[model samples]
Target: MSKFSFPFFFIVLLVGSSCKEERQNDTAENFTEFVNPFIGTGGHGHTFPGATAPFGMVQPSPDNGTTGWDWCSGYHITDSIISGFGQLHLSGTGIGDLADLLLMPTGKTLDVSLFGTTRDSLPYTSRFSHSSEIASPGYYKVNLESNNIQVELTANEYVSFHKYTYQNTNEPSFVIDLGYAVNWDTPTESSITLESETQIVGYRHSTGWAKNQKVFFVVETSEPIVSSQFMANSETLDSKNEAKGIKTGGQFFFDQDSTKTVEIKIAVSSVSIANAKENLISRGNSISFDEVKSQTNNKWEALLSKIKIETPQDSLKTIFYTALYHTQIAPVLFSDVNGEFRLQNDSIDSTQDWNAYSTLSLWDTFRAENPLLNILQPERANDIVQSMLAYYDEQGRLPVWTLYGNETNTMTGNHGVSVITDTYLKGIRGYNVDKAYEAVRNTMMGDIRGLAPYKKYGYIPYTELDESVTISLEFAYNDWCVAQIAKDLGKEEDYKYFSNRSKAYKYLFDTDTGFMRGKSGDGKSWNEPFDPKFSSHREHTDYTEGNAWQHSWFVLHDVPGFIELHGGNQTFTKKLEQLFTESSEISGENVSADISGLIGQYAHGNEPSHHIAYMFNSAKEPWKTQYWVRQILDTQYTQQPEGLSGNEDCGQMSAWYVFSSLGLYPMNPASAQYEFGSPLFEKATIAISDTKNFTIIAENTSPINKYIQAVKLNGESLQRTYITHTELMTGGTLEFEMGPDPNKNWGI
Candidate 1:
């Protein structure tokens, strides 16, 4: 036997013996200790280091600015100043919105003269250093240098709990600002009312990415209010307890003490102030901040323990756990404690049977994040499908991108279809299958986002739309997802029709240039002066966030056909090799900033190129997939604030890292298949279900021994390069023998 085989066999025996007991106590592992919440807060990652529960409705974090792309999450690592701490925040998004219910605790009174001025001139701002800041999965703490106050934040599902400690100051006041808005967000109307001596209720209606957004909040303080000053648009209101206008806020004075600590809790709802109050009450007003903090920590621990990895490298463990943490921050709870949620038409729905969710970044997440959720969080996946169906019922079509209760219509394609289809195909049937099929079918058949032109012309014409080729490719993939459900439902005619529509990508392919180029309305000629590396941001371009080279390989449903389009295996493999070896420079005066994490022309930062590396498996070059996947794993991610290469895009970037590091990826997200890459750990176990566990063991796996030499599934030799979702969930052991060089003949 080889030197590595004895330990591998011994581990297999131990895992097989203890599998059932481990499943019973999966949460016994403290996986949250490995998570670093600030890994993506710097560079262009656009993630916030905040305090939030898993899929919680509230994300309370400090805001540094209201302008600039770096402040999309309201907090960046480079910033030193803090405007205030807001109740709602977006994580790793390209567009910014929802920094509502801003609260600032100060030692001195605010200047009423600067009420209507820009946020930068506000006197309540404070400066803090990174050395004095600390962040983890469910908590954040910072010492404000301006007032010598230390702030700590924690949260539950719908409520944010704040603790402030004042030192060396006599005056202790609080400012409740309803007029605070961040990038892409503008306060259309707001109001604040002091309901009691220690209670406040208000609402903020804004217009931004999600038009006509509504946020109702209820705040409760441990200390009673002594005095109050309400203002609107730089003018003090006549009413001492209330303020209502486009710009509204208030300054409230509490009991003065030299050294004091105050606790505040803020609950929010999309339905009404009454619902927000009920949500706050449901958490028990007397619950201590430390108790809530401990609860949130336990929640995170249970979720993060779903997949336990054994690796010698601590940095890899941190990166893996942090990536996993980011995936659960969104698709947050939208329903109140009383099962009340707002609809897209601004109507309240009080009969929600399941927990409603929002912040669906489907355009980016359907590729990897949703797939990961299916494996780790199958029940939440069902709720996500139900949420999409609810949106379809509220609107005529499914959500492209939604926040809170409104659809932003951001990005392209109805990728909610992909999420629903993937969920159902994975044997999760907590939703109505027929209704999901109808929703996807109607969405693709409808006339929106160039779908009418795509249906009529087999391709969206460049003359009619900006991202014609990109839309056609993405729509084709979604259509494939629709066809899968049709086939499953035994609708033969519908399946055949949609299956043909799924090939709409062929209409945009240019055999002469070997790229997916844009064609005119008449379909007579390609767009002129075409360069594969050229990119433009939402301008006269045929791509969305990428160029021809990146978008051309997006045929996830038909990779074999895509390879054939490039003239068979050898030629296609050569062209694929060139994608990473070509020049990294882009040829455009105004290129999309989304195209980042560039290794030559392969942009790992964006979603378009996420599955391109795995296409080598279809071209019969699995070794190249292993090589490139390892390269991306080593180079594109790290354990620092500036670790990520591009926007987290609501966890899609991190999801890519999580899946790729595990030696598998969902090349076709809805296909329920995972292609193997290079596994990073020696042993990784997944809690497949209540009583079952799936374990993957890689022997002699190190930086030098990166290539897979052989593989076994339950002690039998495996030949295929991919594994099915059914095979994975069946709970068996997948063992791989690692060597220094690629054994190209092993998987083939």
Candidate 2:
């Protein structure tokens, strides 16, 4: 057997043996059952329990009858009815869009007005209970109470498979609502065309977080349509080749036996309608819904098997696996089956052999999700880097909150630098580093979005830019990543330039207040009337969706520098202590709802404070890091539908949980180093490679005995407070002795 493959097999076998028999079974049965997709569907989790393959373009899930904050992903547990199953969705995001090509099937006698322009007006929308609903990795099923129809959804890479079983109707009708949009999204234009009796094609252009977004789809049904009608803005038109308007809808009446199921495949593409059809034809011709579901389940099992923790606590396992599931939901496959994708300005791109990807919440993912991918899915990580480079090649800069081939530029910082640099430093080679470096250097040196003033002055001036302090701090971290890439590429001058620029964050650090605050144009004085606890909800604020207490510790590249600026470890650690123990209250006119899941002022729900708990390691207070990390892990995450304390932010929040639960975190993602924290699990094994396994074993590990007494790597005493990625990938056992009290001397 290959060397790396043995360890993965060992982990699988060992986990199988150690876990309880009821929860331990075949690879697919045990692990798949533990996944609770509904955990984040309720509350503000904004996650969809949809049927989607790993990084697939199609997210076929039920949209609830609402356009509220919790329904960002189109589905919320609190909602009373399912509007329809859309072929697209967003998981754990603040803004909601892409609930495109919504398909609702019911009995032929149902009124068309019952399915209205908005979900709230749809009286025919079916009610579904959690007891009858089922969701796994790439599958979702629900029984609609409106017409007593059972809906089952599954997906491949680019197409969604939907099976509808009507209980008493011999003739079933389906409505395609191309105009349907939810939360912070609006469909500018939409089109639906009847290609044949059994086939249909359409497109929807939208404006939202992704401006100028376009999605083309080709849907094919098992049974031929006996009759069809087109409707636009409440006006019904005779069947035609095409129907185009702002509010376009299509109704297809199908001939099917009452007992037999009617299945349909919807293929989606950002490229073109023909490409969408080609995608469906290429992959959907021979595959059955069950086969597609099985394939998707196996895909998740293989990915989840990369890290196997030997624990009897099913709740922890459920949370870990669900978090792992969230990480694969984005950086989706943009390229179609023929390796074609839409480029900037609605053009076609067919440059590479590897598939292109998008939906990069880089501002969030660069912290932990991307780094986690570098460990668990290095191949995909390399592809994602290439995709970013490809985006740079087209758009002349890396994407911010990009989706559907559009650079949304929604968030701050050119964080694609961090993602690229982190992967490069980990030795994940595939993409062109010189070109990558060019993109990174250009992004840092670009004259757009206050970078000119940021370069002219030491930092971005509050008078010139919004979120000046946060931008400067985030850009400093981005610059540090650029510096690392430059140094590795042997560009001494570039390294020197970015290295100097990386320290520009020091200019915004208010020495008197001990918080990073916005500075004036002269850089001699801070912005006036600064309340560190106050977060201005306006766009023209010093912070972005965060207060000073949260963004103050964002200097991921230089925690030591941050400590020095805060008057040494004693004062620095005390500030961190206060950040945790302080009141969970904010003083502001309009505070950001993104700042939830609060522990004192440490908002675990947002990305800004993600690394703060681990920052205690650098402050020489490892126990505090252990205490807070454990506290957040236990309190912020749960097995319920509203278990998440904050937005999933794609997978950043969940990724943090996965890493912290395992006693490791990527404090500085650009560096290969991972700061150590208290491990929540008793024994965990990571299949690093085919020939190696990195095992983490915590003895006497429990709720009370959460403190680490001692640590040994490969039976050798470990003195460092952090571990490197190289050391982890090389494979060895890291054993931790646990106790109720912290060993204070450990790692010191």
Candidate 3:
């Protein structure tokens, strides 16, 4: 072929590839997979520095975090050394466990301590040198100092792929602990049954946050193993259930090692072994690495497109987009090709037809994540509601921090009801609404552990429930969300009932103290010397991973009502300011590190405070919201490894950024309205749908110029606490002039 022919041929191939990718139904120009997975590796960020497609089932990365804390999602920024990457990790949870299904690559014997940490036992670890590691959001590469091996990791819907370069071909050998498990750190059973030279079905089962989680796997090796070991616990699995689990692995050998690559694909199901087998078999061994990588890249594109934010500051874009990526990564697509899934109830095989989802970090996501999903990707929102409804149908109630098919019920309060109710209210589809109503009511009014404390005490009363003050406040807001949802669905009785239930928080309010205090089980009594910051009985109440100062503003559904609770708009505004800058002197409980964007007592780091900035619209002053929103956009967020100052909280943290940057936030998610907030970009363009596009053009908009001088919708002056979904979806221009100083009287 002539040189010109080769060039023309290459262009044709590129165009053809682009056309083929277009078939996946994702926007292309918007996605850049250059995310550094190692960004959050330091700090108690709990992120695995690994590579995976946006929202894919696989999270292939090194499992460097062995601290067994909630932050160990991947490797900790504070750790001194590296550990092999694990396939699956639970996201942003308070409990430490389930670093299940690990994959390690080596050029020599794996000398690292499987137990994690050496004899000196540093109280806290030193930061990992950045020179030793590299990460982008969708992919990660790390070099182990001890082994001198370069390890790369990536993930797709349910499979993890790894590439390792050994220092020397002869010294290279890898390890797979069929017996490995995490934080409920004891493995009850493990076995590696060699199915053949190239395939192995390994199994291991142990107890952790999800008790009695039986893990079974069928791993097909890309190469043959020269040496492999099978280690099982002294105990054996109940013979009857042996077909289902008891962890095991398959190791392959090579005649001699060079820079050979080992790819291990895995699928985890709450359902059956056969389904897992089908899941594995569906992706035949002949598939190319680039094909899988491309599939993941495109998926990332679609997810990233769901919310697009462009800015002059590249760092802001990285932070905004990365946070956006993190939110959609979990509660992933849980169904297989035939729609087989692990049912809500563990016995499995019940639903070989529909869909099932697990790993719902509801308490955190119920605030921002689900609402964000409802607004942007309503279709997926519907499926998530249906999945939770299915949980209620099969498990008998809406889940409380559900994992795998089991209910760890880790967090306090029932917020998934809010997710269901919020989605349903928005006229979103893909769920059985009536069934969802049933589940919502059951969870709200049913006989769960926290209900009596909720119903009888208005909020969980101290005399009635230990975390009385904390539980009462949060329950009240969620109660309102549920009731609002019920009312929208025309469940009149439920509407009235839950509406009253939501007001239960009023009882806990100590007008004299001007704080939410614990009430006694008896109608007239209250906790003595009430300090909102302190936990009553060390129970996870009076705070859902927060303090009374933090929980005081939990009522985002009815911000006006929350203002009313504070006496009036003026007083409420004063307290609101105090909250943003509130300092904790007592230091009651050890709080999560992600709760760091402090404005006095207000915490922008976690979900509870996500809606706080918009509360300004409810007050006589909207400028404060402008001030803090700009401060957060400029400072709390950056395009660096530790870009986010708080928990990704499954994406709530990032969703908050995405919405804020777009000059809008779901001030009231169920209300089908977006509250205007400070815009971070000079010009933000949102393509709401194929035919509808929206743009925000700021006049003198910048980090210093934070206030909105004025507002206009399409060309008309607009003054409203909220914007309608109609106006937004109509896709028009929202223009504003901003300044560093608050234009306090402008919006008011």
Candidate 4:
């Protein structure tokens, strides 16, 4: 037995025995049972069903192959093959990257000649069936039919635990492929060193969505490695212990044992291999696989238990909790246990006072996910803002899309400004507010992503940039967020400047077509030959992942002005009604696949139209808001593998479901107000804070009774269609009397 194996096994036995009795007596609810990690994996949802703690650094998930759009998360439900299990993965992203440090267990040794030195080539592959697969909040298990090996995976914040049970196999080997890459990811450099018989350390530096991604890892196995072959660039190296090149890997043969079980623990760090080793020693060295699984289960239970719902159907409960589970999967922990992390400038920062986070998909998340985080996970939200501020301090701009420690500068607008403004306005001031404001201001003032032309033309013109209308509208909303922060900081002049800038969306609104059309740089006329339903995928279009009908409602911060732009409340509501009742057909040679969950032209699958359903509240047509909110809640989300209507987009889609299912949504996410919607549950108790509990009760709620007839907050009748964030945080009961028919006069 290896020296590390005996102590680890002894500790496992001791801890398991000691905790058995206590665990039997404990009757805490297991919220993980309600979460189906596979709910979004089948469709364009792009979710991976794997082992990961809430915002965990290590995601030890199976990768199918490094090809195509469905393989964004490294695995798709449609694929039955497994290339290997990777340490890192992106959940529900449109673009793909980061399936680093892949390891595959096989019954036979791999032929190095059969593998090619590219992201697409697989050293070892296996077929797996869904019937033999099981996934929960922090655990994933699959039986590989090709190798007849049962693979079980679990993870904590920093380490991933893998246990492989060989079935009737003579040869049991592991192929640790450092060269493995998927989708947009390409390994720039990689290396592996066998530190000892049972220990291996390596690093994979890659480029893709995250321009400069670095992942350093330490691997420890329970069984002793009897023989090893190191390979680089598809060639076996003369050196037995180490290989260094752009493409590198190692195949290790473990000693045949009667136990037939091999356990592996992998710890990752963004800083260095030393930090990775330290992380494993501190976090994973002594813990058993079952113990780690139990710990991660408890952690997820605690977070998921924060919001408890009593629904009529078990499936609804599953769907609701699954959505909640998806919301906590990103902006994952970036700082190591010792407060060491890689800064944006390719330097290490060891002085971080708090946990740093990455995977900030600001364009999608700023709409709902960040707002939901401010309420549910305020402490982490503060850390996220701090991380963004750190990025700004190093790179002189807030992150557009950050993964690991690299900024991708993806998507559009200064939505990071919106996330910071929302976090600060929500009173989660754990971060430096002044520095945050400076980041927001500096980011907005920068001449990038069409900002220069936007400043000159008031709105981005089609002549100056593609996706002009979409960029202008999103920037306007972000400008409104900046205005709010400036106003709160008592910078009146700056506030006035940004507040005016916030109205830039009006420049693109063409009264002739009643749509926000792209304008020419001359500002004399709108871009000609426009169609509201025309959309182009990643082309020179005025919209991004959406058409005019969707981008026109991007003015979430100034709904009143937007309503006036349509002439009046009646006209506005009519146009708003048309958005959901018009033709759902989109016309283009290459229409964006993101325009899914179509209720007419209101694409619920995407972010731009997320708040559109609640716009009727401002128009005094509260019943319409309630009706459409319920419609979306019922149809857009489900419990099956292809459940989600679109890409979860790092939790924005799920966050929308979470808030809307609770009968409220952030129409303007930074506004600190939640507009009323149709609640899906009979009753939901939200542990708003450690001490405060906010409960929502829907009396006589059923499938038919989807509309609110009356409303009450704590025993008094509520007249407004919206509630303030302060009201919710203070903790009270918000009751809704539901009926088959809408009470048009209720909130109005």
Clashing pairs in 4: none
lDDT score, residue 118, model 2?
74
Clashes of each: 0, 5, 48, 0
**Residue 399 error, candidate 4, Å:** 1.0
Local distance difference test, per candidate?
0.87, 0.83, 0.63, 0.87
Better of 3 and 4 by lDDT: 4
* List of clashing residue pairs for candidate 2: 3-690, 3-691, 4-690, 4-691, 5-690
Output the worst ten-in-a-row residue range by lDDT, candidate 2. 1-10
- Cα displacement (Å) at residue 631, model 1: 0.4
Q: Candidate 1 at residue 524, lDDT?
A: 79
Candidate 1 has an lDDT of: 0.87
Q: Please identify model 1 stretches exceeding 4 Å from their true place.
A: 1-29
Q: For model 3, what is the alpha-carbon lDDT of residue 474?
A: 63
- Under the 3 Å rule for N, CA and C atoms, how many clashes does model 3 have? 48
Stretches of candidate 2 above 4 Å error? 1-29, 109-116, 256-259
RMSD of each: 6.4, 5.0, 7.4, 6.4
Better of 1 and 3 by TM-score: 1
Assess candidate 4 and give its lDDT.
0.87
**Which ranges in model 4 have alpha carbons more than 4 Å from their true place?**
1-29, 116-123, 257-259
Ranking by TM-score: 1, 4, 2, 3
